[model samples]
Target: MAATIPIGPYHVALKEPIFLKLEVEGERIKDADIKLGYHHRGIEYLAMRRTYWQNIFLFERVCGICSDAHTTCYCQTVEDVAGVTPPERALFLRVLVAELERIHSHLLWLGVAMHIIGFDTLFMQIWRDREYVQDLLEIITGNRVNYAYNTIGGVRRDVDEKTIRLVKKYMDTIKNAFDKTVEAILQDPVIEARVKGVGVLTHEEAKRYGVVGPTARASRIASDIRKDDPYAAYDRLDWEMIVFDEGDVLAKTLVRVYEVYESIKMVNESLEKLPPGPIVTEVSRFPPGEAFGRVEAPRGELVYYIKSNGTNVPERVKVRTPSFMNIASVKPMLLEETIADAPLIFASVDPCVACTERVIIVDSRTNEKKIMTFNEFMIRYGRKRK
Candidate 1:
């Protein structure tokens, strides 16, 4: 006989709200179903209502880990619609901040994974190194999380020589600390036993499911948006896209670990190649048109679509985050894995439910559409408590 098991909607292993329904026979999972929409914030609708300038901040809140990527893509899309391009210096600066964020995001995910596997010591050590990257981000962008650095045409601030020097100093420290940590993790026999063959997603399944980022790379799908569609200073820099053929948890771990080194190198290169001149290109008006923009976020490809109506406000705004695509692939990964490994397998994808959530209600008979705030929906649909 098979039984259904539920993990999350709210669980310790989940970073945000998501529901997983697993059908298990004995200890092995037979099938898995994923449910989302618990964390919807109506971001797209809000973006349409706010001015183009305001949308930057709005979109930045899409995901705290990928905030800079969100603003970068949103600003780029708006610039595309308005027929404007940022300065050369600004492009390099974008790359610098983006790579730094990537390092921090990967470290954060790694630390969380370690904790899920009951390796608290490794988790603490990884997070301690991650703090150095956060300090570097704060030094460069002012704020650690939502940097608020990107604007319509270019970045809001310039990177001075002193700041550049600080970036170099911190990158060296972070790289040294990170290398030692990686050595410790790779040498740990327990970690090896736990993650080596668990949650396997083959190359064919990866391609068929259309996963991205380290998850896809770990499966030998060498698809990187930075290399595939060059943007910012990525084309100018020399960095290799990390790939692995195993398509297992260990492969995923190694892919991220190697990518952190790649991100560190990219940051240093961007700083050395940082050019002179203005950081922004001012645009006073936006023309009527639709444009799309994307970036290789820490998680994966983050896409933004903007439709401008010759006004300050946008006509429509749509976002397709990487988690939205990657979360579904978890179904295939969970199949045949033990229930004990479920959380680790799920965490391996680093799903950001907040980024993936969006809700738009439509009436069936009249085909009427409505968008409601969280409070409004909760008040109307709240189950009465006895």
Candidate 2:
């Protein structure tokens, strides 16, 4: 007989609240179902009400970990609508920060994955090294998590010679420690036993489900937005996308591990070649049109679509975060796997539920079954006193 096991909205295994329903027969899982929207913040509707300049900060908060990627994509979309070009120096600076964020995000994932696998010692070590990247981010952008560095016309800050030197210095630190860390992970028998051949996502399965980022790359699908659809300073910078064909948890880990090196290399090259110019530019207004922008976020491809009506505020603002695309692929990964491996398999994608969903309230008092939009709910609740 098969029994259903529900893990989260709140469980010991989850980093965040995401409900997973698993049908298990003894130790093996027959199938799985995912429930999202538990962490929605109504961020897309909030973006429509805020001006283009203000939305940078708002969208950045959509995902605390991937804040820079959100703002970068949002800024790129606004730049398209307003027909504004950021200075060359600003473009390089944007790339620098984006890569740093990628390193931080991937390291964070590594630490969490380690903890899930009962490798707490490595978890602590990964986080300790991750601080080097976070400190660099704070020095560059004035904040650790939400840098608020990106603007519609350009970046908000400039890099100095001292900052450039610091970047290289820290890259060296990363280089020194990275090899030993990877060696320890790869040589560990426990990790190899737990991860290899577990939660396999075949190349065809990866394409059918439309997975992205390191997850897809691990499945031998060399799909990276930075390479396929170049944006920001990615086209000018030389870096290779890491791909592995095994498509298991171990492959995902290796893909992210190598990616950290690539991101550091790109950042170093960007800083070296950063042109001397202004960081911000003047954009008078947004024309009546629609535009779409995408960035290769740490997790996957983060996309933004915007429509303008010649106003300070946008007509429509839609964000498609990477987590949204990657979460669906988890269902297939969970199938036929034992319950013991479920958490690590899910964490392999670096799932961020808060970035992907929003609230929808249904009125069940009269059983009328009315689903309230966020805008309507706000207006009804936010009416002014007469």
Candidate 3:
């Protein structure tokens, strides 16, 4: 007989509200199903109502960890639709902020993973070191979490000489601490025993499932949007895409740990090579057209689509976050794993459920289901007044 275990909607191990149904026989999971949509905010519908400028802030709230990535992709898509290009200096600044956010996000995810494995001491240490990156972000962007750094044509702020020096100083500090931490994590016998050979997703499965970011890289897929499709200063900067062939939980950990070092290097280089120019360009009007933009976010590739109608507001706004792609891969990872290892295997993906929600409402009275576009939903159910 098989017993079904439910983890989430809300659970101690989960960071956000996601429902997982695990069918287990004995201690081994026979099958798994993931359910989302509990955290949907209808942001696409909301974006259609707000001006292009306002949508920058709106999209940033998609996921606190990937906030800057959201704005970067959103602004880039709008810039594409409007036929504008950000200044060279702004592009470097964008890369600086982006890499810093990546460092912070990976560190936060590492801490969470450590905690999931009952390694509270390491979790505490990792989170403590994460503050240094946060402080560096605060120094540059003014806020640690939602940086509000990106704008329509370029970044909202500029990095001065003092800020550049501070970034360099902090990068050195972070790298030193991070290197030691990585060494400890990789050498820990308990961690190695727990994570190695667990939640295996082979390269073929990774490609088949269309995983992205560190998940795909851990499987030796070599699919990074920053490298695949050049954006901001990524093409100009010198860095390497970290890849591993193990495709297990430990591989995922090592990939992220190595990428942190790469991110630090990219930040330093961007700062050293920071050019001189205006950060933003003025855009008078948006022509009627549609454009798509994407960025390699901390988790993976985040995509934004914008349709313009020769107005200040977007005619349509659609987002497809990397979590949407990576979360599905968890189903394959969870199969045949123990219930005890479920949380760790799931967390290995660094999923952001709130960032993956797409809402659909069904009328129970008639058992009728209609997939409506943003415009249709607005016109049909939107509040009306005389």
Which predicted model would earn the best TM-score?
A: 3
* Alpha-carbon local distance difference test for all models: 0.91, 0.90, 0.92
lDDT of 1 by residue, 1-386 (tens): 99999998999999898999999999899999888878878787687678999888998899999899999999999999999999999999999999999999999999999999999998999999999988888988899899999999999989899998888999899999998999988999999999999999999999999999899999999989999988888999999999999999999999999999999999999989989999999999999999988899999998888888898999878899999889888988899999989999998888989988867677899999787664565467783111
Against the true structure, candidate 1 has what lDDT?
Answer: 0.91
What value does the lDDT take at residue 300 in candidate 2?
Answer: 94
lDDT of 2 by residue, 83-129 (tens): 98888888889999999999999999998988999999998999999
lDDT of 3 by residue, 1-386 (tens): 89999999999999899999999999999999898879988888788889999989999898999899999999999999999999999999999999999999999999999999999999999999999999988988999889899999999888889988888998999999998899889889999999999999999999999999999999999989999999999999899999999999999999999999999999999988889999999988899999999999999988888989898889888899998999999988989889989999999999999988876667999988666665566678764211
Q: Which candidate is the best by lDDT?
A: 3
Worst 10 residues of 1 by lDDT: 377-386
After the best TM-score superposition of candidate 1, give how far the Cα of residue 224 lies from its true spot, in angstroms: 0.8
Runs in model 1 deviating more than 4 A are 360-386
Give the residue spans of candidate 3 off by over 4 A: 363-386
Alpha carbon lDDT at 2, candidate 2: 98
Worst 10 residues of 2 by lDDT: 377-386
Count the clashes in each prediction: 0, 0, 0
Q: lDDT-based ranking, best first?
A: 3, 1, 2
lDDT of 3 at 66: 85
Evaluated at residue 309, the lDDT of candidate 3 is 88
